[model samples]
Target chain A: MTRRWFLHPHAQVFLSVLLSAASQVLFKKSAPMSADASPFGFAAMSSGWAWLAALATIGSLLAWLYALRFVPLGVAYNLSGALHVIVPLSCWIFLGEKIVAQRWLGIALVLAGVLVTAQSAAKIEETIEKEIEEKP
Target chain B: MSPFAFALIFASIALQVGGQVFFKLAMNQTHAGRTARYVPALAAGVAAMTLSIMLWIGLMSKFPLSQLYPYEGIERVMIVASAALFLREKMTPRLLLGVALICGGLILVTAS
Candidate 1:
């Protein structure tokens, strides 16, 4: 029962976003701001955390592609907005990062926008399918 | 931020959007049984994604993550717009409102 749920396409989308947030946090941790941290340099590649971050990124991309097979790009893409919330929260909890009240408000707005976008995407997809069926 | 910084941000987002669109196109082609076209589409998608990562890494190295992340919201908006344009995805008024709210929120986050 548990295994099947993990294989669900929507579940994959959720997993992808979670992994993406994880990767971002890991990357941020591995690459501290420094004079040698040039734009094109690979200095961070020396860190074990950086490699794990890369692996997470690759895993997220693969999960995303698998989900895309079943979900419309529009819907799946909008759902990814959850990253805005997840990444910030992860940083706060795991890294002892501080988010200001204003940023928290902004995060709330982003969550609302994600819900709105998701609702519209699903409705539009249904209408499009109906239109195609009615055409001929 | 400098104009050049803005340009780099724009470029990174565009490349990522291009990557996603290509991947969707590849999937659509597969479903349509145009399998021969799939390889090129997938290849293009990978190339675009790789370039976007390189650019993103460069941006991350230059700027703080807090300052850089708001641009991710902007990237989502761009991706949705491109999906409508390239993938024949229809955009509704509600979708537009949602995207607007997201952009506004990101702007606020940046301000904060």
Candidate 2:
């Protein structure tokens, strides 16, 4: 394995998040046709979308695995909320779909919340590290 | 898609978006029904999926879930702009304003 495999706890989490974002973008780019449109479609049609989705789902599972190593489950789960904002906006923009102004505002609020949460976590980590260093 | 949605839910959201992109491309082709028409798009989707799984595995191995979760907000911002640029979608001024507000709020929150 490479040296990078042994990343700091925080960095690992960051990587996972970055990958998750990438997965979402790619998944959005690769979807198959609708079920309603394909009356005679086999499992392959579903698999096309399912497989791509599986990649993202696997990303989440991996994130969960990494997260368990350092951060509390509650915190990790909370961070996953960011996907709520990212996924929809991506759809609206890339799919040529419409999103109302009010919904946009909601997305902003959620982003704000996430930032606040992250800041709090950083502070907590620092405090914890300092206390540990002071101990004999 | 509900941002709260996780795992399968999130995946479904991505698939829907990806599907639409493919549909649009397929429509533009002379033989829309031909499997060949969708190959590129399908390939792109699969690539995306694979990347996601890899990233998730890496993340699960290292961080506290809480700390990393917030990055999703940043991802959202990226998606909006990317979609507009790549998909030729229109972003209303109000939406842009909303994005700006969110960005500002996120900055403040993180700075604290």
Candidate 3:
């Protein structure tokens, strides 16, 4: 797999992953801070941590947009799948959350899956580029 | 628990997938203001996502988070399928494997 895409600022996929995962964790941690989390809970909406989570979400969204400009939607989506593991693992470590054994196994599977996906993405991109060249 | 709620969940998934696809289409545009295509796609995407959020809120009121969480895993699979079909993106065996693993992992994680 080429490291070029990883280093490219325009790709931003890696950065998107980090920011999105952070947003998930922040949103989870801040959920309890909201006294009432109903559809129209004005007090819950104004919580400081909720606002922080919202900011993180906005950052993640912008990073996603930036990344999409460079990468295919499929590859970008697959790369971000690692957040399934990251958010929970970070929560277990930082938030003192309890994770059962099965969940750990699942997380392991996800990490392996993401590695394979990342490798596949470069190969696919090369093929697509080749196709584009051959056609024109 | 009813068919209608499940339908709402499915609609939400469709909307989310639609929004992502349109956003991709929007960004594929070369010019900022001139391309009439991207703007419509962008507007539709945002509108779909906004409606999706409302559906999700409705779903949350009816079902437990754990019950509804599996749909997010379902979403991972759908978006890949979506890219393949609508965006004409290539999908490989490893990519499919990755999707399965991630979905499985998401299910196991949320089940806990």
Candidate 4:
């Protein structure tokens, strides 16, 4: 099989990530106003919007299944939580949402942190490869 | 985050941002008595968003918060690119510099 044809587990994980990102943008753009728009409204207001949200949720579940097939649990969890920083900031700029300077700085720091973490991970992989090679 | 993990997180962030932009565009098409026409697009967008969230939950179930959080930076790059391409948003020198700094930082974090 050609290298491209081979589904590297990591590639699957990456695709899932991309899908997840795309889905988020779509859903937010389409989401209906909250049913509980009132000061004390308790129930969710129903519309076609909720149904769309449900569809997005299903897509996410499918992606999760693929992600779990190869990636370890610990790694997946960390990656998802980090979305908190990414999704909101992107919305600020692309969607014309207001973002304060402090928040922007925080986002920058988060990006820097990701790079550092990735580099460390690569070093770990290198060490592991060397150790495997050295083994009898 | 692992490289794969980082990529996934970044992608998810980008989509979330994109969704917001799409919704705004759709909403801008509003006119009296035309809410029904836009329903289909809205539905699709919502589905996509929910799917993204589900993916995130799945990732969370498996990984630690610290490891996954930094990959969010990838969204910024994606958003900036999208804005430039689709929205005709200006790419100011300061913004470009910011993007570079963020990229470098993300690389450092990932490499460390």
Candidate 5:
């Protein structure tokens, strides 16, 4: 095996999720808080946080692409749902945001979903690898 | 949220899903040695992703991160659906159950 442990599919997926969570936080930090937040506007790009958010997004995308080489897009996409939980928790911790009871329950449910999906992903990958091996 | 905002959210999600599917196609093309198709597929992927980010940032300016991020859960469901539709990825029962849980959580998050 190569020394690039981070290039491992699982590691790439984990890195992609972490970077995506960071990107969400930074994008929120960069937001102009204007009522006229048009979807095509460039207002967010004025902030330094926006640049960092862009960088985080690029990193996440590259990692996700790398992971997709080994894992099916379905599995990789499901694995990335971890970002929903991470972003909210990060916002609460670093951005001093509050999570209401209903939102907390929602986040918990999302976490459960991610865990279950990840488990299923492992099984799917195993079966695929086995089928490939058997295909003399 | 206004109807316009809801439309933006749905458009952003669609673009994101399109980006992922295109990127997956590019990767598969690369592995298949179809270099001619890879560049355009990868370019399409990048363009869709860039547009999605722009829309997401715009939406973030109007909504709280906590409230908005849950919408990403919806993308998880959509991507899996698209993967099944476009990529022919099998949708196991466990995967469906997981996605159903995510959708239920999203309804709660967005509803409250």
Candidate 6:
């Protein structure tokens, strides 16, 4: 109900966002290098980013698990959609992936959606708090 | 996509959603200080997630990263629905708007 959401509880959600995006990037990097011939690919396993991807994924899930304690799964998951914007941008910056104008427009829309979702969640929280106060 | 591929994708996403719900229940239990109550939920969550990852890997083997990633956006809708149903969270109009915008934007971004 305070800035505590940003500074404390939801910070874990933010970390989930970053780690999830990073893991996706690592997967992207490793994808091309993965051996195409077999299910058991030492080539993919040997890639450092692939391993990092696995770790980042576990880290993201752990952070998400902790975050689900205080935050509504709806709110946390909606904000996690920020990765729609984050992953491609990270790929563009770090992986030199191409960013066409269309993608940029899509990114803006995704950001707008995130803002709206967050604002909506905050409104819900405030309403709940007001109800609790009135009842008590 | 082939029927098998589509089914795999659907199953993978379903498993991911199920895992998320299990994880949420586990955390909620833990929050109430019933630490022992969370173990089965956590184990189930992990199992669902493992299946999801395996199914996803199978799907990705056939599809381009760009083509398949947008399907993940479906999570926003699934999570919102599940939250409303299970957690009794109120579904506001703005939240729906946001979900629409996100899905639209994701479709746009992933379009090649």
Error of 3 at B33 (Å): 9.2
Question: How much native contact recovery, as a fraction, does model 5 achieve?
Answer: 0.64
Q: Write the per-residue lDDT of candidate 6 for residues B1-112, one digit (tens) a residue.
A: 6786677788888999998888888988875667799999999999999888766654555565667878888877897899889878677788788888888888888884
- Give the Cα error of residue A92 in candidate 5, in Å: 0.2
**lDDT of candidate 4 at residue A123, scale 0 to 100:** 38
Candidate closest to the true structure, highest lDDT: 5
Can you write out model 1's per-residue Cα lDDT over A1-136, one digit (the tens) per residue?
2435576656788899999999888888877776556665377788888899999999999989876765667677877878888988998898788899999988898788888977766665555444334431
Q: Model 1: clashing residue pairs?
A: none
Task: Compare candidates 4 and 6 on lDDT and give the better one.
Answer: 6
Deviation from native of the Cα of residue A101 in model 6, angstroms: 2.0
Worst 10 residues of 4 chain B by lDDT: B24-33
* lDDT by residue for model 5 (A23-99), tens: 88888888857887776658778889989988998899888887776777887877777776887789889888887
Q: DockQ, in order, for the candidates?
A: 0.52, 0.04, 0.41, 0.04, 0.61, 0.47
Alpha-carbon runs more than 4 Å astray in model 6: A1-7, A33-43, A124-136
Candidate 2 per-residue lDDT over residues A3-76, each given as its tens digit: 43344345555556555655555544443334232212233324454466556656654554444344433333
User: For residues A92-118, could you state the per-residue lDDT of candidate 3 as single tens digits?
Assistant: 776676779988887888888888888
Q: What is the TM-score of chain B in candidate 6?
A: 0.90
Model 6 TM-score relative to the real fold: 0.85
User: Of the pair 1 and 5, which is ahead by TM-score?
Assistant: 5
Model 4 per-residue lDDT tens digits across residues B1-112: 3576556565567666566445434433342337676566556556656555555544543453334545655655665676567655555554455455555545444444
Give the best candidate by TM-score: 5
Provide TM-scores for the models.
0.87, 0.42, 0.77, 0.39, 0.89, 0.85
Q: What does the lDDT read for residue B78 in candidate 4?
A: 62
- When 2 and 3 are scored with DockQ, the better candidate is 3
- Cα error, residue A41 of model 2, in Å, equals 12
Cα error, residue B97 of model 2, in Å, equals 24
